[model samples]
Target: MPALVLAAAQTAPLAGDLSTNLARHLDFIALAARHGVTLLQFPELSLTGYELALARNCAVTLDDARLIPLAEAAQRHAMTIVAGAPLRLGDDTLRLAALIFGPDGAIGHYAKQYLHPGEDTVFLPGEAGLTLTLDDDARTRAALAICADTGHPEHPAAAKRSGAAVYSAGMLLSVNGYAADTQQLQGYAREHRMAVLLANYGAPSSGWQCAGGSALWDENGEHIAHAPANGEALLIAERRADGWHGRSISLD
Candidate 1:
């Protein structure tokens, strides 16, 4: 398989600043493009910022004006992009989910099905999750998840059963209580024999601190690439004959 460059975008989104967040995302996209990255993954709730209460006003439809520029950019750069967003699914619901834009301007979205308690009060649970090809040419079957989705074994199991070769999530992984989940997530990937990638959030909000250290773990229980605790970074990983290889892309 051709090497796949997966970027983990860790950032703290300032509520209601879609333009600024988009601008930052564009810069990271450009940087990843320069590295010949095939796909770029960002933290959950990246587009609208992760402010829950604020997400209502920031939530947008897939065809909304905000996504146009991003679609164009993805097409131009030939990079598959997945990031978190709030999409207006109905007159009464907002789904917290990951939206994918292919290099050819194709759009696919995955809603977060697994809710972490309080999420039920604010967002509508996703009716379905999606698995799409990561690279159109090479065509690696891929599935996406949001923050808490990765922590649950059932979600990843569902992805594997759904014909996904690799599972990816834009997780807002917190520094505290992460070691246990990280280990479990890794074990799940290894046992299921699937590749996994997590893009953690860097800038903490809600008085909750996070260590934006993105991680990549392959089949057979091996961590190929990861960022240190609490920082912004771009992690690059490759699929090889034996398993996988990876490193970090320094944004200097």
Candidate 2:
């Protein structure tokens, strides 16, 4: 089998501006395509920033017209793209969600199962986990996670139980919590025996100064790639026959 290539995008999202951020996401997708990335992950609420008050208005459904371009890009690049946004199931039901665009133009979504403090004010916890089979290989399953979900040990544990080979998280981490949060992700990789990927914001979001150290870890918990703490970059990790190889591409 060929190597499985994945990328974690560290970006600076414009607060409450879905149009601008959507364009940025498309640009990043094109860039990742150029580098042969098969899967691309972005930070939490990347499409509309982390503004809780604006989530209700920005919530998107699967058939939203705005998502057509993303679906097209995913098909064009033959990549699976995971982008974060506020998802609305009903008038009062909104969840922090990861919108998944498959290479075949199919759209799937994963809501955050765990909630951080203060998030309950506007969002509901997700009920189920999502695992995606990659490259038509059932052995290559990638589990999706969002902010606060990684903080719960049982979350990744459940993913492992579901036979996921990779545990990928999208987050909006602050500078003060970066060290501990990333350390925990590394620990999850070590404990679960699954490769891990983290995509975090590179700039301020919802009044928090984000710490952008997007990273990837191998199945054995070895560091594969890590982005700088305060820049826009693509942290790419590839699982080859030899092992996991990685590189970082600066977008700034």
Candidate 3:
């Protein structure tokens, strides 16, 4: 496997502000490109921002005007970017993870199979756990989802069953605490021997802070690094000869 510098852009997102959020996403994409990153992951619903009822109006088709610039950015940089957005599949609407243009163009898509208890009011449940292998850029057999999608075993475990080398979930969490959740997820990584990345939102919206503690767990489920509370940072790690070596990227 090639050395892939996978990055996650963690930032604050304002409600109903597509341009602001899109700009922030592009900024991070540029940052990652400068570092020679092969793939970059953004938080769930990163383009239009996460509150569903408030954002349904902004949701548009794949060719919608707002999404054009993002596609251009992906094409311009030749990087793979994953972000959450509302998608129109036939007549039915879905809250889907849009895996946009990469070296191979937009080749993969995954929908949230489980809608959280509170989220059922805004989004529809996605049926299948999607898996695909890109053009040898990264033999990524990944299963995609948003925050709640990772809580269940179906997504990650399904990826393991599918033989994925990596598993990812874009999230909007709270800084109040997700200690136990991370603990459980780490154990899953160790038990499955897979690389997992939880891309999260750093911004506080709707009175609760989006937990900014992002992590990368290697095959042994070792703690690569977790972000401290109330901060914007990137936790970077590399799979070296001995093991994964890492350092913090302070973006505050």
Give me the candidate number with maximum lDDT.
Answer: 2
lDDT of 2 by residue, 104-140 (tens): 9999899999887778988999999999887775768
lDDT of 3 by residue, 1-252 (tens): 445566666766778687787777777777777776655777777776676677567665665676666677766777777877766555656555554555444544566777777667666777777654533754656555577777887678887988776677677777655776777678778878887777777767656667788777888898776655555666565555567665557674
- Write down the TM-score of every candidate: 0.93, 0.97, 0.88
- State model 1's lDDT: 0.79
Indicate whether candidate 1 or candidate 2 has the larger TM-score.
2
Candidate 1 lDDT at 184 equals 76
In model 2, how large is the Cα lDDT of residue 145?
Answer: 95
- Clash number for each model: 0, 0, 3
User: What would you estimate as the lDDT of candidate 3?
Assistant: 0.68
Quality of model 2 by C-alpha lDDT: 0.91
In order of TM-score, best first, we have 2, 1, 3
- Whole-model lDDT values for every prediction: 0.79, 0.91, 0.68
Candidate 2 versus truth, CA RMSD in Å, comes to 1.1
Error of 1 at 59 (Å): 0.8
TM-score of 3: 0.88
Stretches of model 1 off by over 4 angstroms after superposition: 90-92, 137-139
